[model samples]
Target: MSVISEEHVRGGSVFKDISADDDDWQPTEIESLCMNCYKNGTTRLLLTKIPFFKEIILSSFSCANCGWTNTEIQSAGRIQEQGVCYTLKVKTKEDLNREVVKADSATTRIPELDFEIPAFTQKGSLSTIEGLLDRAVAGLEQDQVVRRATHPEVAVKIEEFIQKLRKLKEVENEFTLVIEDPSGNSFVENPVAPQKDEALTVAFFKRTVQQDIQLGIKADDDLDEEPAGNDLETMRNEVLTFNTNCPECNAPASTNMKLVQIPHFKEVIIMATNCDSCGHRTNEVKSGGATEALGTKITLHITDPSDMTRDLLKSETCAVIIPELEFELGMAALGGKFTTLEGLLKDIKDLTVSKNPFICGDSSTADRIQKLREFGEKIDKIIVGELDVHVILDDPAGNSYLQNVYAPEPDPEMTVEKYARSFQQNEELGLNDMKTENYEEKNNVPAVPGGTE
Candidate 1:
C-alpha cells in the first residue's frame, strides 16, 4: 500500500563523503560577510550526490575574526513522492555513533523524555548520533547566558533540562529517537547496510496541508473555499477550480467544482479531483444552501438487499448511527458525501479500518487494529443486508437526505422527522448567533468609526 520507492541504502562504510566534488573533492569557495562579526569570511558550497541518495548542497561558512562557523545541508533534488519518518532505538552507548542525515524541515523527538526539536529550529545536518546530541546541547546552552541575567528560575530549569539531554549521549537507559521529515529527504544510518538494521525502522506517510505548504509543494492559499451562498442560477454553469495537494501524495492538484442538483433537493456543489502526479481520483460534495430552521432525523430499516442501492446524502454536519451494530459515528468523522447505501458502508469501513491512522503497523497497536477490522466486518454484513439494522441520519443542518425508493408513496420502513434544534445544536451550527432581521436597534450595535452610510 505504500507508494514510496525505496532509496539506495548505504552500509559498512559510514558515508561516501557526500560533500566531496567529483574531481577536486573540494567545495566551491566564495568570500562573504560574516553576520557574527561583520568581518570578511569564507563560504564553501558543495554540489554532490550521495550514493543511493539524491543530489544535495552542503555549505560551510567560517569567519576567522570571531571564529564563528556554520554548516548546513540542502536538497538539490525534487521533493520525494512521500514523507518519511525514521525511528531508532538507542539501547547501548555505541548506538550513539549511528550517522544521521537530517533535513531542516525534519522534526526530532525522544518519546522517553517527551522532548522535541521542532522543524526549522536549526539547520539541516549530516552528522552522527553523538553529534546530533551535541547540537541539541549547544542549542540549549546558546540562550542560557541571556536567560540567567533576566530570569533565574526559568534558566535554572533549562540548565536541568540541558543536563538531562547531555545524559542521552551516555545511553544509560534504552530510548527511542524519532525523526519525521515531510519532505522525505532525511536518513538514519543502517550499520548493517544492504542488510536491515534491527534498531532502525522507516515509515512513509502522506503530508498534511501545513506540511505541503512548508515544503513548497503547494501554496498556502491554494486550497480556496467556494464562494459562499451563491445561487444556482448565478454559478451553476461555472466550473470553479482551486489548487489542492493530492490526498495520496501531497503533490499539487486541482479540484474542479460545479453546482449539481439532486431530485427534490436543493443545489449542492460537487468537486472532483484527479491528481496527475499520483493518479489519485477523488470527489467531495457540499450543500450549497443555508441551514434550515429545524433539524431532520431520518431512520431507514434495512429490510432487503435492494436497499443497498438507496441514494444517501450525508452532509458535513451529519452523524450516522447503526443500532444493530451499536455503532454511532460522530459528526465531521466522514466528510460531506453523496453516495449509494453500499458506498456509504464501504466509506465507513475504510474510515475505521484502512484509513485509520492507528491501523496496525506494530505490536503495540494490534489489538486496537483488530477491533477496527471486526467493526469493518460488521459493516460488510450490513452492506450485504445480512444483518437487521436501522440506519439513522441526524443532521442539525437539515441538509441530509436518504432516497425514498417508494417515491410519492410513503416507504413503510422509513420515517422522516423534524424537530426544533436544542440550544447546544444551535450553537454548534452557529444559528444561535445568526442575525438576519436585526435592525441595528434590536442589539444597539455600534458603528465603525469611519463607517459609510
Candidate 2:
C-alpha cells in the first residue's frame, strides 16, 4: 500500500523525459540545417495582408505529412506575407552567415539531410528536370523583381521587367553578389564568366537587357518613390498588426483549431476565450468574418458529448481531480474511466476510505477497483470489464521506478477472447513484450531490479 501526493498529478511526468532507449534515434548535426542559409529554412510566409517570399534561402522543404502543398496564387489579396518580403538562395558561406546575423530569423529550419517538402505543384507539366528547376529558380527570381523595382506601377508586374542576378554558385547550390557601390554600380559590373564545367547560367538583366554589359543602362531617377505603395503599405501595416497572442493580456492560450478550409468547407473558425485576472471573459473571433484567413481567432462553445468523449479518449494518460484525495490516489496505481480530471471525482464521498490502499497505475481502473472492493464487501459476482497493474522498475538501491500498464481497448477485428488475453498479458508483463520486439539482444537495456508487474 502506498500514497501519491497531489503535486505529482501533472502532465509533465509523461512529457518531460520522453525516453527512447536507442542512441541511434537521437538527432544529429547532419539533420540540422544552417540557420543563416535559406532564412532558417522558411521558404514562404503568408501574413494577414501580403503574400511574398523572403530573400534568405532560395528554397526549403515543408512537411508532406502535415499536408503542406505549394500552389500559384492569382492574388496575394488583403493578407500579406509578414517579415522579409523576398528570399534568395544561399549561394555562399557569406550569404548563409548574413542570414544568421539578421537576428530575427525564422524557426522552421529542418535538418538538411532529413528534410522533404510538399511536392503538389504542377511539376508534371515540366518536360525536363532542367525546366522544372528553371521554373522554380525563375519564380524565385521574379519575386526579387517585385521587391526592388523603382517605378510605382512595377509592383508584382514581373513580365515587363527583366530579372538579372549574378549566378553566385558553381553548381548553382546558392547565389550571392557583393554590391560594389551605393549608386547601384554593382548592378552594372560584369561578373566573371562561369567555368566551362559549371552548370550555372549567370547573367544580370536590366529592363529588357539580357546580359551584363558595361555600366551602360541609365539609372532611373524615379527611385525616389517609397518602397511600397498605398495598397502594399496598407497590406504591410495589417500584416505588422497581426497578434500572435491574446489581445488583452498577451497570453498564448490560443490554438489553431479550424485547420482546413477547402472548397466544400469554405470557412473555418478558430476561437479562444479567456477569463483572466481582469474578471471579465474575453472572446476572440477569427475567420468568422470575411474570408477565412490563416491566423485569426474565434470563440464558440462546444456542446457535443461525442466530441468531448473523443477528446477524452485521445490519450491513455490518467487525469485525476479530487483535491482532498489527490495525494492518496496519485501515488496509488489507477486506471479506467478516469481519462479526465472531473470524471474521476464523481464517486468520492465522506466514507472512511483506506488512506494507504494501493491504486493501480491507471486511475480509472484504480477508482473502479476501489468502488467494487468497497461494494463487493457487502455484495457478490461483480464483473469488471478490465484490469490494471503497477509495473515498478527499481534501482539497485531498492527505490521503485513507478510505471503504469493498462488493458487495451476492445477490438472487433481481434476476437474478444484473444483481445482479453493480450490485454491481460500487457498488464502482467508491463514492457517485456515491447523490449523483446524493439530491442536487440546485443543492445538490450539493463533490467531494473523490481522486474515485470
Candidate 3:
C-alpha cells in the first residue's frame, strides 16, 4: 500500500463496501500497472480488525510477466489524537504470560536491558510479553550495528546486553516492560486487580507536533479519545441490580450486583446487600462465567521475606488450607480477597485475635488462645524468612492463582497441580448434577480453565 501524504485524506477516507465473508475472509483484488516492471499485475488487499487496536490494511502486488512482488501494511482507521504508553512489571514467570499488542509504529524499551526497538522495523504483532522480548533479542542479534562494532570492549558490552535479554525469560530475573505507541494502537493486557494495584500502569499523553509529523500523523486527528474511564463506567452500568428480602428483618433490601473480572480466572458476580431496618449487611459472591470441570491446587513454601510481597488473587470458591498449622479456611470463611501473602496472613491472625475474648474467661481456652498467639508469631517469622511454612490453595472452580516470579527457572519451593474434582467437590459445586455431554449440543462451553490449563 502506498503511504497517503495528505493527513485529512489518510484519516477521513474509508474503503468502499469492504466487508468480511462468512469465514471472515474478504479480499479486494485489482489489476494495476507495476512500478518496477511496467507490466500489469494483480494487487490484492485484505482488511482485518486487530483486537485492542484499529483495523489494518494488508496489501500484496505481484506481476506475472516480470516476476515483481511487493507487500505492505497500513492503518485503515483514522489517526489517534493521543499516544499510549503501557508499563508492566515483570516480577515473575506468570507476568510473562500477559498478552501484548504492539503496533508497527510503537517503540519498545527495556531500560534495565539498556535496549530499545525503534518503530517500523518490524510489523505489528499480537504476542505474549515473553515473545516480545524474544523478538527484541533476535533483532539485536542480527543488527549490523552490533556486528560492525570496531572496539572489542563495545562488542563485549553488546553481547552482555543480549545475554541480559535472554536472561529475562528466566523466572529469577525481574525487569520492566515498556511500550509507547504514537498511533495509540498498542496495549498490554492488565492483570485484573483493584484500582490501586501497581502491577500494570497505562498512560495516555498528547503527542507533540513534531512527533506527529515524524510519524506521518496529523495534529488535528479527532478519531482517538481516551476510553478508559468510559469503559469502566460502561462495565459498571451492565451490573445486575435488584431487591431481595432480608432474612433477619423480613424487610425489602436492595442488592447491588457487579461483575468482577479476575485475571487468568473466570468472572464472578458480587452481590452485596444491606438491611436498613435491622442494620444488617451481607455480601455473596457467585461465579458468573463458566466453571472448570477439573480442580486446581497451588502450593508455595514461604522461603524468603520477599515472597510475602508476591500478589495473590483468591476466588471465593477456593479454600486456603495450612497443613502445617492444622488450620483450614473454607470458602465461607473468607470472600474473594486480592492481597499479598503477608496481607493474607495478617488478616487471618486478626481474625483469630477477634475471638480471643471468649477464650480469656476459661483456663483451658486461655491456653489455646496463647497457642494461637504463638502461631501468629510463627507466621510473622515466616513472613520475615525466619521460618518456612507451606501455603496451599485448593479451588474446585480453578479460579485461584499464585504469582510466579521466577518462571522458566524452576522454583523448588512451589508447585501447581490440576486434578479431576472429587465426587464431593463436584456435588458441592453442583457440577455433578449438570451433564457435560450436552455442552457441545448446547453450544455453551466455559472459557479455558485457569491454573496450569
Report the number of the highest-lDDT candidate: 1
Residue 385's C-alpha lDDT in candidate 2? 13
| Segments of candidate 3 deviating more than 4 angstroms | 1-45, 58-74, 143-154, 193-197, 218-453
Which order, best to worst by lDDT? 1, 3, 2
Candidate 3 colliding pairs = 92-405, 171-406, 171-407
Model 2 regions lying over 4 Å from their true place = 1-453
Worst 10 residues of 1 by lDDT: 1-10
lDDT of each: 0.78, 0.25, 0.70
Cα lDDT of model 1 by residue, 301-369, tens digit: 999989999988999788888876667665555668888989888888876667543343321155555
Query: Positional deviation of 2 in candidate 2, in angstroms?
Result: 68
For model 2, how does the per-residue alpha-carbon lDDT over 16-112 read when each residue is reduced to its tens digit?
1123463322211112233334222213322111101111111223432443434232211111111111223344433322211111111111132
In candidate 3, position 13 carries an lDDT of 34
Give TM-scores for every candidate, taking all chains together and pairing residue i with residue i: 0.53, 0.16, 0.38
Candidate 3 lowest-lDDT run of ten: 355-364
Ranking by TM-score: 1, 3, 2
Cand. 2 TM to true fold: 0.16
lDDT for model 1 comes to 0.78
